[model samples]
Target: MLKEALAFKRPLIFADSFFVNKPERVEMILFLMSLCLLVYNLDQRELRNSLKRAKTGVKSQICKLTDYHTLRFI
Candidate 1:
């Protein structure tokens, strides 16, 4: 298994064909998510402090909605 191999530095390459529009939707979602997370953490001190203080809270739980979206492909 690649996980157990420890020496798994094998180089791999793809022909850049699948790098087109099909997976762009997923990548776009992640990009937008990243941007939202960036702007959100930037604009709100409360959110930052909440993240700093939380083991469990609704604000922290909000990412789980996006996780469900990401999980849909699997």
Candidate 2:
């Protein structure tokens, strides 16, 4: 899961989209990314909980119904 989450943030390794030479800058960027990932996971959990409480589900990528939708999908 950790690997997938990190890969999701930066899809392409050779993209060179973000370049930080300084250690402080790299640390800051990592901190921000971690915070954002935390928020994303929390939001997904809340959505899943709410759907379960409501006894409803959204269609998944396979076109099947699922209340425990993944954070990466939906």
Candidate 3:
């Protein structure tokens, strides 16, 4: 549903509540969406590993927050 809209170059404004409530699903969807965008732009790679991780379906179901965050210090 959302993917279809985004695929057609339509504007998308996902509410924070959506991701907040379904962190894992949201991340998985985001990763898949990125793959679609990559294919559309003709820049794709084998992200099978990441895809596998997403299938676990157990993320921030309790707190409605992302389970992890990373920072790069350079």
Candidate 4:
């Protein structure tokens, strides 16, 4: 999700220096970031699917029961 991509603060910071000094390295940095996000999302999807199949929910930050889990929750 766009929110997940935007929430990646530390990776952006880590890739900042590379963008300014070695432009070519930017591709690799972006690739790695994308890969990490993909993995995170896939895992989240699996968790949500599993929970749904089990017909259960978890408490969110606000203490309300939710079937959909966000990155912040897990």
Q: lDDT: which candidate is best?
A: 2
TM-score of each: 0.32, 0.75, 0.32, 0.72
Q: lDDT per model, in order? A: 0.43, 0.80, 0.45, 0.76
User: Model 3 lDDT vs. the true structure?
Assistant: 0.45
Among all windows of 10 consecutive residues in model 1, the one with the lowest summed lDDT is 65-74
- Best by the TM-score measure: 2
Q: Candidate 4: where are CA atoms >4 Å away? A: 7-20
Ranking by lDDT: 2, 4, 3, 1
lDDT of each residue in 1-74, candidate 3, tens digit only: 34643554434544443434577887887898788665743321223334356653223436443423211100
So what's the TM-score on candidate 1?
A: 0.32
Cα error of candidate 1 at position 50, Å? 16
Model 3 clashing residue pairs (backbone): none
Candidate 2 C-alpha lDDT tens digits along 1-74: 66766675455444367788899998898798789889988898899999999999999878888899766676
**Candidate 2 runs further than 4 Å off:** 1-3, 8-15
Worst 10 residues of 4 by lDDT: 11-20
Clashing pairs in 4: none
Q: Provide the lDDT at 30 for model 2.
A: 75
Candidate 4 lDDT over 1-74, as tens digits, reads 68755674655355344434576666777788789878878888899998899999999889988889966568
How far does residue 13 in candidate 2 sit from its true spot (Å)?
Answer: 7.9
